[model samples]
Structure formats: structure tokens, C-alpha cells
Target: MTQRFLRVAIALVCLTATTAWNDASSAVAETTLGIGDKAPALDIEHYIHEDNGFGKVEKFEDGKVYIVEFWATWCGPCIQSMPHLVELQNKYRGEGVQIVSISDEDLETVQELMEQEYPGKEETFAEVTNAYTLTVDPDGSTTEDYMRAAGRNGIPASFLVGKTGLIEWIGHPMELDEPLADVLADRWDREAYKEQMKRQEQFQIAMQKVNQLAGSGKFEDALKVVKKVLEDMEGADDPRSNLIREQLTAFQYNLRLDSGDRSEEVMTFFRDQLAEAKKDARELTQFSYNMMASMQQGTDLGPLAGETIAALKDAVGTADEEVMPIMYVLIAQMNASMSNFDEAIANQKKAVETSTGRTKERMEQMLEQFEKMAAEEADGDQDAEGDKAAEKVDAAK
Candidate 1:
């Protein structure tokens, strides 16, 4: 496995272990609810709002579509999407569509938050959220029935329940409009959605296996799974396919680098990939960064350093304004590693000038360090010259 991939996998494993779910695999397996499946019933403990008035709703009525959204007041994205949800509710109210915003917080917490004043706004939380139906999941019955049953581990999740009580779609609330329009117009394609979900499920299963093998230091085995995924996704226009291909290439490159006999082959591969990446500024920047990172990790690039530097310079010539600064920093590091301190300091100074925020601050710090190293080298050279002159004078005497 590539270093980046391994780091990401480790982080994901740690997160999954600490989550409320038993394990990552179980969490993946539990997502059994899919399109065409009958949606679970709404079992809310308390209804906070009902169509401009306060009341309760026990069940979803027939011939009416419902948007069951799970959200919390503290979730920034959830709060940001509230007004959009309100707008959607208003737009579809005449079509018998109701948006039910469910929060798992206790009734007391919800009430207090609603009454509390918000920062930079005259309206309280309750005033802003009064347009849609709000409810508290005091016993988590609605959550268990809807969110858990669908194997959803994150909030801001939404499900569109068709008039027939079947789930037509599931995704983030922000992406609800397109599918909602389809469902209301009686043109939603269940079969296509099922196929799409099946592909995603298969992809998740493959990644889980790859993660397991990689986490155990069995990269050779993990490589096989990665290649299989790439093959399975070949010729597809899916973004995931491209991501998997990149991972596969990185893993292969690292494995070859570790092999003592494959030096020539790996160097050739690097040259070819770098040439291809140079066509795009962003791609070249990423390529240069990865190469520099590998060098920092003690990988001996030897003659490839010169080649990489040349390619980076070419990339910089055509790079975008925002990307040029990052490329310059990498180039500076490459030059410094090659003992070309003058060029390093110059490029780093340029980086400091072009960058902003924390990046500019960091580049300024690196420039200072490079300058110090140059000064030390110069002082050492002068000391050596003085010693030689003294030795010559003593010999002449």
C-alpha cells in the first residue's frame, strides 16, 4: 500500500472502531434498506411544530409524499440547510408533500435552544425553524426505525417516502430536490437507482477487504484486490474508478521502489508518469509533492532528482496563480536537498511573496532556515581558507 493510502485507511479504521457501531464491516452490512424497500414508520416522541401550529402526527397518510430528515441543531450543515428545507416545504405543500425534521435531542434541550437568542441575528432558533414540522426523538424510536434500519451512521441524512409507503430515495437533504421532483411526477426509476446502489455496495465491500489486507502489512495481497477493483471499473466514467486507478498506481510505485532489483523499471515509470502529469498544473503539483515526500522519507532518487526538477520547472511555467506558490516551495526543497542552496533560497523567497495565510507564513519560515544554512556554509568555507593560509606561512618560516 502507498503511504498516503495506509495513513487514510488507519484513520478510517480508528474512526469506525470508536463509532457507536460494533465494527466497520457490520456497519456496512447493516445498510440493508434500499430503494423499493418499504420505509419504516414514523415513531416520534413529541411533535414540536405542525403546519404553522403545534400538534402531533402518528402515521404517514396515504397519497402523500413525505421527507423524513434527521438533523440536529448543533450540526452546522444541518442548520444551513434548514431554510432550503423550509422553501421546499412551501413549494410542495400544495402537492401533499410534508417535510418532517427530526432531532434526537431531548424535549427540554430542543425547547431551550429554540428559545435562546442566536448570534448576529434578531430571530431565535425557534422563530427561524417554525416553517417546517419539527419534532423531538426523545426515545430514539424514529431514529432506530429510520436511520439505524437504513444503516445510516451520519446525520443530515434524508429519505423520501413515496405515496405508497416505499422509500424512493436516500441521500443528503441538500440533494433532495431532483429525486423529490421525480417521485412527485411519477417518473422515478427504481431499477436504475437499485443498480447504482449495487455498484456502490460492491465498491464498499472491495475497499473493506483492501483495507483489512493493507492494515495487516500484507500489501502484496492488498495490491491484488486493488488491481481487481481497477479492472472491474475499467472504461467507466465514474469518478471512483479514477480514484481507484490512482491508488493502484501509487501502491505499485511504492512496491517497485522497495524492490532492490527494480530500480531501472521504477525510474522509467516515474519519468513516464511525470511527463503525463506535466500536462496539467494541478496534476504536476501533486506529482511533485509526492516525489518530494518520498525523498524526505529516505528514498534515493539519484539522477531522477534532476529530471523531476526540470519537469517541475516546466509545470511552474504554466501553473495557475494559486498553484504556482506551492510548486515553487517544492522546487526550493528539491534544490536544497541537492546542495544548491542559492537556487533554493531564491525559489523559497518567491514562494513567500506569492503565498498567503498560513502557507505564506510557513514559506517564510523555510526561507529563513535556508538562509541560515547558506550563511553557515559560507562561514565554514572562510574558516577553511584561513587555516590553509596559516599553514602555508608556518611552512615558509
Candidate 2:
């Protein structure tokens, strides 16, 4: 995907984590179902493993609470949350709670992954996830019944089903503890949760508008919306606010740079942001990468290229080991764009040396390409010299 599309996708997905849910009536209008709605019945086609003293629970039973989680093996967050789910299962097993982890991947793929050894742990996936029930939905009936029915579009989604077989809460797996406890104790305040959902609905609507404006290349209009959000959002120091501010600044800089409004002023604006972003390695790396990608997309940085190189060098000084290799690769690309072949080769070598795996292999390939270009340039110069000498001899004759 293009960088712009990718950024918007990430923003939309992450906004859900920060926003609250809508009221039941409004949520039902917005989605197929909402909290307090009866959950669809379990549609497990087959069970891979049913441990934890609970075997093949084909349906939600009375006097029992269920944590029905949808996940996949390729999801990093899903894998990380496995241990937490295990802990929850162990803690609530006596309280009549069962955690079921469901995946839609093929049985062979799931089996291989379950049997394969993971780094830092010798336990198979089956052994590691022995505390909870494991199942595969080849027909996707379970996912359609739960995730699609609830209007959830992403993975690692969780539903806390109460004793009455109603969805008490729906959110990320990590956000399940408090709601689970409340549902177990019969103290969940449905009204309050509904109000929170309403607020979340508002946030979601606003974010969609902002994303649409930005996607349409209306950066100035988008900046206005961003400013409005920053001013109106409740918490000034909220991470979401900070993130939007960063985006606003970046948009403003791009707008100025694109318009050619004030060359020196745009450079100053970018340099100031670079200085502030350098303190955070992740932000610095991301900013630098975006800049590099923008240049590659044909946005000429001109004199700003030197400034960007300098800023990248400064970022490198404070960047952690993980980010260093990427920064080096960006620096090498910048130098190559300026026809500084030797410098490009040197920086690329450093990147290759510092990186490993696919990254190292890719860098090695780039290094070879750069070496070939340099040799071609040398040969062209030699050809020019020979032509000039021939001309001199012809004039003498």
C-alpha cells in the first residue's frame, strides 16, 4: 500500500483503542449487534485441543462465563497476549470461567505452528496453550457468528459472555480483565458502559472525517480538523492528542514544502521538528523514513537534503541498536541520490554489517548495485579521456 493509505489504516485501527463505545441503541444502529445483545451460539467445526477440565463445550452453558477470543498465529499481539489469557484462565477456572482461543487457519498450518519450537521456549504451542481450549473454524461459521455479527473488523478481538449468554463486553483481549471481573460479580454497569460507547462513536466519526480529508490531499483542510481535535479533546497531554499534533506538524511541513511558499522557512520548520523528534528514537526513525520515502516518490528535497542528512546523523547518535541499521540505509540512499557514490557505498556497507536476516541480505544486494554503478561511471570517464586524446592527435595531424 501507499504510505498515506498505510498511515490512515493504522490510525483507524488504533483509534478504536482510545475511543469508548456508543449507547446500545446507537451501537445497534451502527453495527449489527452491541453489548447487552444475545451472543451468537458457538459454531466450532472441530476442536484442536480441549483441556482445562472443560472438554468440547459446544455451546454457552448456564452458571458459566465465557471469554471467546478470535486470534491467528501470524498476529504478534495475539501471540503476546497468550500468556495473559493463560493467567486469566487459571485465575477464573474455579469461578466457572473458560477461555476459548479460536483461529480460522487451516488445521495443518495450525498444527505445524503448535508443534514448532519458538525462540526462548522449548514448549510446543499445544503444550504452551494447554490451559485453554484451542479450536479451528475451517468454515468461518464461528467468526461469522461472533466477530462479523458484532461488527468487529480486526483480529485479537474478545467477547465476554455472561451467564445469560449475553455479550457483557467487547474489546481487545488485553482489556478484558476488569469487565470479566465485573460480569463475574454481577456488578457490570450497562448504562455507564453505554455512555462510554457513545463517546467512542463520536470519536470514530471525527477520525473518519479527518482521515478522508487527509487522504484526498487536502492537507490544509485536514490541518484545520486536526487543530480542532487538539483543542477540543479532553486531555491535552493524552498520547492520542500528542500523536495528532505530530501528524499536524508533519502535514504543515509537507504543505509548505509542496507549495514552495518559503524555501528557507520550510527548512527551518522541518529542522525544528527533527530536533524535537530526535529525543524519541521511534519517532525519529519513522520521521526519517517518511522523509526518505517522500523523496523517493519524487518530492525534491533540494538544499533540504543536506539538512535531512545532518538530522539523520544526529538521530543515529541517540538511536538504539535496532534503529541504527535502518537509519544507515536511509543515509546511504540520500547520499546516492546526490551522486556521492563512495559515501553511499560506505554507509550501505555499515548498514549491511549491522543488520541481519532479510535486511542484511537486501543491503548486500544494494551494495553490489552501487558498486556496479561506480564502475560504470569510471568506465564512462575513461572513454571521455580517450576521445579527448584522439581529438588532440587529430588537431596535431
- Highest-scoring model, TM-score: 2
Estimate TM-scores for all models: 0.54, 0.61
What tens-digit string does per-residue lDDT give for candidate 2 at 6-29? Answer: 233233222211121221112222
Instruction: For each candidate in the order shown, give its overall lDDT on alpha carbons.
Output: 0.70, 0.69
Please give the distance, in angstroms, between residue 359's alpha carbon in candidate 1 and its true position after superposition.
Answer: 25
Worst 10 residues of 1 by lDDT: 15-24
Best by lDDT: 1
lDDT of 1 at 239: 40
Worst 10 residues of 2 by lDDT: 16-25
Name the lDDT of candidate 1.
0.70
Which pairs clash inside model 2? Answer: 21-197, 21-198, 22-197, 22-198
